[model samples]
Structures are given as structure tokens and as C-alpha cells.
Target: MPRVPRPAVVAAAALALGTLAIAPATGDGPAVTDPRVVTHFDLTRGQSPENIALAPDGSADLTLSNARQVVNVTRQGRTRLIATLPEVANPHTPVVGAAVVLGIARAQDGTLFVTYATGTAETGVWRIPARGGKPRQIAQLPPAGFPNGLALDERRGVLYAADSVLGTVWRVPRAGGAPTAWATGAALEPRNPRPAAKVGANGLRFHRGAVWVSNTNAGTLLRIPVREDGSAGAIGTRATGLYAIDDFGFVDRHRDTALAALTGGSEVELVRPDGTHRVVLTPGDGLSNATSVAVRGRTAYVTSAAYFTRRDPNLLLARVHQRDRD
Candidate 1:
């Protein structure tokens, strides 16, 4: 989450969506649709779904941020506990108040990888076995760095973790090893360093020979080329005006179009290759502070954290339509 207060974000979200209400909705543009709520989580239990990874069996694996738990929500909305990260010796985080789990990614073999920000030596990347047992720390990150998003490059045997507070992306061996700072620059740093909750480089994904990242402070999406030698190349700004984009996923394999979750805007946007975008889903579609989105086949799964609404944190299922131009 950005270093801004939740209440402040709530106000911004409402204002942004209100402005979109008067915009024209063409057939090829943003369309209003009724999305199905798969399940509503208990906010008191800290069951806020932060990042999602879809399984082949139609189940979704998620990290319950404040709860420090990893769970699987099946197609039928049945949720099962996969693993709970061990408690941090110190619960306080640098910018955030408490220790929390953030991003999650699943491997083909059912193994799970996640990030934990504990503001202590324990803060780092963790791995849970496919058979389900204790979670082990694979790499230790900076105690003050808030690692917010994670992505695994299976082909390269590399795992990239984004540090929102540090404005850097760290790479670790998939099997477990020391992490190296893979990418860092001004584009990844928060505009204001003194803000309580300001964040940068909030989400990450390895796509098409580049690492796509979201800058919450700048409201821009960036693409960093992966060089032939597995090093990061120059960074390019792909899109802007994305208010509080938390996480996003590609809509089609052949197209660069993506469905991005706007946390502070309480909306889902369809971002095109040309950097144009339109709001596709909103509060009317059951979105309450959407945090992350995962697209599979013709379906799009969105997770609402409800950090601002303080009400229904839920998982929503919607159908995705492709444009003829793509």
C-alpha cells in the first residue's frame, strides 16, 4: 500500500470515480457489467487478499496481508489455509504500523513463494513446500525495506521482489539464495520521501523480456527491459494517470493489454498497448478498494482489500471481453 492514510485514499478514490461518471462509454471502451462476488472475507480476521495467483484447478492462492497467512480459495468459494508465517519478534514496520504479508506467487509444482515485511531481520522472501509444512525464509531483505510485490521467472530460475519503500527490485534464486538488487532508479522512488505511507514500485511482473512495474506515488506503469545477460536495461514509462495502481495482469497472451486494479480509485482499468486506458469496473460492480487482479482464459479475478471501506473485503469474478483491434 502507498504510504498515504487509508482515509485520504478513500476520498481520492471517490473523487476519481465521480469524474469518470460523465465520460462516454463506447462499445470498444469501458463497459459496465455485473460481476459475481465469489466470497466476502472477514475484515476483523485480517483476511484481506493482497495479491493473487491462479491455479490450474481453478483455485486462487492469496496472501492475507495483516493476517500473515496464505490461503487458497477454490472455484466454489471454499477457502483453505495453506500456511501461516511465523510471528515477527518485533511487530512494527517502518512506514506501516504492523508486520504484514504482501505478495504471493505459485509455481507449477504447487510450491508457494511470498514476501513478509516485519521491520526486522526476519523480513524477506519465504517459501512453502507443495506438501504443506513450515515456511522457510529463502532470502533476507532489508529490515526497513517494504517488499510489496513478487514475480517468479520460472524459465530463468529467478524471483523478483519489489521493495516499495526502498525503490528497488531484488532478485533471488528460485531455489533459495542471497538476493541482489536487480533494478533501481528515480522512476521507482516515491515523489515525497517524508510521507507516512508513500510507496514506489508497488507491483512487478516478468513479461515479454521485460519487468513491468507500477509506481503508486507517480501513478505510472514502467517497463524495464531484461538484457541478454539477464541484467536490467533502460526503464520506459508505458502508461500514466493510473491513480494508485496496486497490481495488474495481462489480459491476453498475444496482446500487451492489461487489467489493472486501482486501489485508491476503487476501479479496474483496461490499459492498452498505446498507453490509453478506460475504467472497466467500479464500486457499482462490487469493487471496494481493489488491490490486485489475475486474468485466466476469459475470466478476471479481482481481490478487494476494503482497507478504506472497512467493510466487505471480497473476491470478485468477471468475464473479460477482447477488443477487435487487438
Candidate 2:
């Protein structure tokens, strides 16, 4: 999602990088036990972790949206450079208005796939070798469209990318070729006329037998069933009232519940299938502005871009308690 400037906050997110700290839960929600910042990124260098892809070896690959870089972080909080995208020739572009890397996904072989929403011909999905090298653009999307979220279905060798501005889900082959519009509807269109809040379909994922998408402006989560032929079936709303949700990951293998990042609200919520939800982390828990959530078993990894707070952009780790139920 594009960085939409916001008002400042009072207290900034605390806890030194690589140190452990616990923050009491705000509101009436349950306490998030043992939440700590794994890494404190340099805001001046635009090292904001926008999206996360978990590696098989337990490392997290992140897309530094504004910096146009992909980085890898080990479980011990060690960060390493993966690859950086091309520099933007012009600052002013249509749609999102600026060049930024939004979403990322990793293949089974360690290859990394990312989306670069540049308002130029260079805008598209790029592939980076696992060992690291010059990144290659595999799919080309419309320059006017902001491709914010990406998901790779390895079984089908297809990548699903959500274009926030175009309100379309594009299907691209992993091998590289032309892209096709997989799904499009008003449910994925931006209704908010505000310059900063005009994003739609901000996060995407492939789970079970369907593709799940988050409509940022509409505050809804949609599920599009994948037919036997690998085509999209009728679209359905799985949840609503998820204001400012950017990215999320299923907490359980059944896919009945999820840990969603509420970016503008600066919190992570435990959302259920019936649309009921509860805050699990907040600004008090070292979250400047939660951007994306990646869940691995009982451990949850969350990224805070600090786009609004403009303070400590960091990565947080928390344990997802399974005993609590709605």
C-alpha cells in the first residue's frame, strides 16, 4: 500500500532493537504476552518493512516499500540485504503517485517475487534469484495501476497480484509471460475519495482452495473460490469492518481465523470467520503503525512502517495464544 501521510502521535514505540519487552494490552482486549521488537529500522533511510514472506529455514524476507529493497531477517533478528529495485526516474507518478515496492512472496526454491508499483514501464512483478543477483521483471502491469499485494500459488505456478488503483487481480505465470485479469468488481474498487485513503485490495493470499483479498478502502475481506480448472469462481465476502487492514496471515491451518495488521489503527487483531475480532497488539506494544502480519505456527511476526508516527519503524514478534476463543 502507498504511504499516506498522517498526523503525529504522542508517545513513540519503545523497546530497543533485539531486546525483549512486554507491553500491557490496551482497551479491553486480552494481553499480548511477551511482545518485543526484533529490529528497529532506520526511518531516515526509508527501511520500512511493508510485506513479509517467511523462508523455509525460519527467516523472514521483507520488502522495504519506500527504499525499494528486499531484505532477509533471521530468527535471531539478524538482517541481511537481498536485493534493491531500480531507482525511480521521476518522483511524481499517476495512481499511487510514487514508485514503491509493496508485496512479496517466496517460491519453494528460495526465489523471491515482488511487486514494484512504479508509474512507468518498469512497473511490474520482479523475480530475484535465491542467491541474489540482478532482479528480473517477470510480469508487466499497467503503469497507472498500483500493484500493492502479491501471492504465489506454487501448485499452479501462477502469481496473483492485486492492483489497488485498477481494482483488478492479475494472474501471471511464474515462468514469465503475459498477465490476465483474474477478477474485477466494485467490491475491490476504492470508494474513499481522500488522496491518502484511496487504496483498494491492499493485501492478498492463497489459502485452502481460494484466494483471499483485503479491500483497504472498503474495510472488507473477500474470498474467491478457485475452481477445479484453476479459474476464479464467484466472489464472496468473508469478513467486514476491518478498517485499515493492509496484510494478514492465517493463524490456524483450518484458515478459520487470522492475525490481521490494522495499519492506520496501529494494531494487530485476531479476526474470526464470523467477522468478530479482538485487538492482540497495539501502539503500546511497540507498534508505530502495523503494516503486515506473517504467522508461523504459534509465533507471529508483525511489521510496523511507522508511516504516521514517523518514529521507530520496527519488526515485532509475539506468541499467538490458541486457548483464547471468540
Best by lDDT: 1
Which candidate number maximizes TM-score? 1
Give the poorly placed runs of model 1, Cα more than 4 Å off.
2-32
For model 2, how does the per-residue alpha-carbon lDDT over 219-314 read when each residue is reduced to its tens digit? 778899899998889989877767677898888666557788888678888777676677778999999878898888778899999887688998
Q: In every candidate, how many clashes are there?
A: 4, 0
lDDT of 1 by residue, 1-326 (tens): 62235654544554344322222323363332558889889888888889998899888998889889999898779998999999877666766767888988888998999999988887999999985679999999999899989999888999999898899999999999899999999999865444454578888877887889998767788999888899999989888878778899888666777888988767998887778788889998899889998888778899999877777888998887655375
How much does each candidate deviate from the true structure in C-alpha RMSD? 3.0, 6.3
lDDT of 2 at 189: 82
* Steric clash pairs (candidate 2): none
Lowest-sum lDDT 10-residue window in model 2: 7-16
Q: Return the TM-score for each candidate structure.
A: 0.92, 0.90
